[model samples]
Target: MEKITFQLPDDLIAQHPLERRDRCKLLHLDSSSGEMKEHVFADIVNLLRPDDLLVLNDTKVQRARLYGVGGQAGRKVEIFLVDKLKDDEWLCLVRPGKKAHNGDKFYFSAREYCEIISILADGSRRVRFVGAPASEIMEKFGRMPLPPYIKRDDTSVDRKMYQTVYANEGFSIAAPTAGLHFTEELLADIEKTGTEICRIRLDVGRGTFKMIETKTYEKHTMDPEEYWISEESAKQINTAMKKGRRIVAVGSTVTRTLEGCFQSNGEIKASHDETDIFIYPGFQFKVVGAMVTNFHLPESSLLAMVAAFATPEQILTAYNFAVANRYRFYSYGDAMLIS
Candidate 1:
C-alpha cells in the first residue's frame, strides 16, 4: 500500500451547512480510466446506471445537545447525550469535568424537565431523568447537537438543513454526509431508471470525529458504531450480486453497513450489532462495487476507508483536484463518486 497523504486548507472546512442541501459542489471520478470531472450535486443522476443498487442510511438525528448545572447553576455546563442506557438514563459527556465529580446534582428550570444523577469515572455521566423518557425530555429541552466545528449555535434551520431529505428513519447523531447531496427529485429520477434503492441504519459515533493516531493501520483501535441490516435489504443485494449487477453504496456508512453484514459465503446477512471493522489500503471489499462520498478530514479513518475502497493513489489524485478546484470540504460540503 502506498502511504496516504493529502493537503487541504483549514479555511475550506464547512462551518455551516449550505442553504440548499443539494446545492453543494461535486467532484466526480472514474477509477477505471482515472478521469475526473466537476459539477454541482444535481449532476449525480447522470453518473448512475440502471439496476445499480443505491443503499442509503435512513438514520434520524436526535436532539442530543443539552445544557444544565453540574450541581451549581453558576457552573453552567454543556452536555452531549451520546447513547441511551434505559428509559430515563443516558451515557453523556459533560463539560467542565474538573468541577463535576461523582454525585453532582443538576436541576434544570421547571419547564426544562430533566436532571443529572451521577458522573462516571471516564468523565461521562449516567444521567437519570426525573420525569419522562429521555426522548420526551430531549424534545422539550435538547438542542440539535451540531458539531463543534460549525462555530454557531443550533438554530431551527439546522434542525432541517443538517439532515437529508430522506432522513426520517436510524436515530443517528451525525448524518451519513454523502447521502446529504441527494434530493427527492434526484431519488425519484434515479428510481425511475430501474435502479434499486434501499435503506440501512448505522448509528454513527462521536469517535468518528477523531483523526488517525497511528501511521500503521494495524495499530489503531476503531470505535464501534451501531448497525442494523434487515432481511429484505440482504435479499435484494444478494440477488443483484448473483445477477452480476453492481451494488453502489451511497456513502461510506452504507458501505460499512453492507460490508459489516457480509457473510462468509459472499452473501449479505441480516445483522443487528455494533461494528468496529476498520478498512485501510489492501483490504478487499466484499459488497461495494462503486461508492459516493464526500471529501474527508486529513488522516481520518474516513479517508482510509476510501483508500481501502479504491487505490490510495486514485483517492490522492482526486483529492488534489478537489482542493485545486476549491470544492467545499468536510461533512456539509462537496461529494465524490468513485467507480
Candidate 2:
C-alpha cells in the first residue's frame, strides 16, 4: 500500500470539468516500457486498433442527495440515498445522524416526505417514503451525489456534466469518470476506425471510492457492487477473446465488471451478479488488455487496481510525470490510457 501512496498538491485537484469534455489532456503510458507521451483526449481515436474491443460501463449516476427539514427542531437535514431496499424504502446516510432517530419524519416538500424506519449497525438509516413515490421525490428534489473531494454544492450543471453521454441505466451514485471524457462525436469517430464498442453495467457504490485504511492491500475489503452483461455483449466479448483481440476497458468499473465475470472456462457468459473483486499487484488479470481511466486518489483502491494493471513503479513514475506537467487530477480531471 505504501508503494501506491504519493504526495499530490491540493491545487491540482480538478474542482470543475472543462467546457468541452474531450478537450482535456490525455496521458498515454506504455505499461511495459514506462514511457509516457501527452495528447488531447480527442486523440484517443487514433490510439485504438481496428481489432480492439472497447467496453464501457453505461451505469448512470442517480440524483441521490436530498435536503430537507425534520426533527423536533426542524433542523435542515441532508440525506444521501445509498441503495433501494424495496419499492419505497431505501438505505441512506443522514447528515446530523442524531437528529434522525427511528420514527422521525422528514419532509422534502409539502407532498414528499420520509420517515426513518430503523438505524443500521453502520449508522445508516432505513427510510420509507410517503406522500409520493421515492423515485418521484428524488427526481424532484435530489441533487447529484458528487464526491466530497469536489468541495462545492452541486449545481444544475452537474445534472448533465457529471454523467456520460452513453449512460443508459440509472443506478450508480458516482459517474464512471473515464467515460465522462467521451462525447457522442468521439464515440462515432472511434467506431469509424472499426474499433468495436460494447456496453456493460456496474452500479458504482460507496465502496468504489473507499480509501485503503489497512497497512497492506491484502487486509482491505471491497463492498459488493451489482453488475450485468447482456447476451449480445457477452457473445461479442467471448468472440473477441477467442480471436485474441485486445479488450480495452473504459473505466475501472468496466474493468472490474469484465474481470470479475470471467469464468474458469476462459469465456464470459451473460449474467447478472454482485462483485467485490479487488485487484492489486500480483493478482493475475484474466481480461482487460488495456484501460482508459481518470487519475485516481492516492492510497485508493482505484489506484491500486491501476498499479496492478501496470507495474506500481511504472504507474507512480507516470503519475509524478503527470503532476510535474500540471495535469489535472480526480474525477473531473485528465485521463490516462495504459496499454
Best by lDDT: 2
Per-residue lDDT for 178-263 in model 1, tens only?
88878899899889988899888888778777678776889887878888778898788888888888999988788877776673
For candidate 2, which ten residues in a row score worst on lDDT?
260-269
* Shift of residue 285 alpha carbon in model 1, Å: 1.0
TM-scores, all models, native as reference: 0.94, 0.98
lDDT of 2 at 29: 93
Candidate 2 Cα outliers beyond 4 Å, as residue runs: 263-266
Give the Cα-based TM-score of candidate 1 against the true structure.
0.94
